[model samples]
Target: SKKYHCTYCSKGFSRPSSLRIHTYSHTGERPFECPEEGCNRKFSVQSNMRRHLRVHRGGRPAR
Candidate 1:
């Protein structure tokens, strides 16, 4: 059972931090960004951006 519910959609999070990150999916407010020269891509989660950084290191990004 989850305590934190998303007001934007039918989703819930057991942790408040998880709920905060989930809200980005609804708000389109990506706080994490790729700082690789001209790539200039953005993401809502830091882990995704870190994984994306792997591409900069000649590594494939995991889906």
Candidate 2:
């Protein structure tokens, strides 16, 4: 069972940290940004930003 619930939406999470990250969806806040120069890409979660880093390192996305 989810221990934390989002006040803005129906989504729930097992951890408060996860719930906090999920709230970014409703707030439209992207805290994670690409480190590469000229790349202004942003994401709501760190994991997704980590995945995006692959494109900067490999010049292409994973298939």
Candidate 3:
């Protein structure tokens, strides 16, 4: 079993990609943005961007 640890937290990951994603949590960098008109929400990852889109699709305000 291959186990990788994140330097920023006590969590461990089984893949290097997972560890890389976990590092972003500590950096607070938002590289993903919404493509909707008049929408300027940004997220640290694509997954979060998708989550935000869900809210917009549900007709909820982005806050």
Report the poorest 10 consecutive residues by lDDT, candidate 2. Answer: 54-63
Clashing pairs in 3: none
At residue 24, give the lDDT of candidate 3. Answer: 82
Q: What is the lDDT of residue 33 in candidate 1?
A: 82
RMSD of 2: 3.4
TM-score of 2: 0.77
Candidate 2 colliding pairs, count: 0
**lDDT tens digits, residue span 1-63, model 1:** 899999989698899999999999889999988988999999999998989988897786643
Which portions of model 3 miss their true places by more than 4 Å? 58-63
Candidate 2: regions farther than 4 A off = 59-63
Expressed as tens digits, the lDDT of each residue in 1-63 for candidate 3 is 549988878689899988777788998877788978889988777777887886668955444
lDDT of each: 0.89, 0.88, 0.79
Each candidate's TM vs. the true structure? 0.75, 0.77, 0.61
Q: Alpha carbon lDDT of residue 50, candidate 2?
A: 84
- Rank candidates, lDDT, best first: 1, 2, 3
List of clashing residue pairs for candidate 1: none
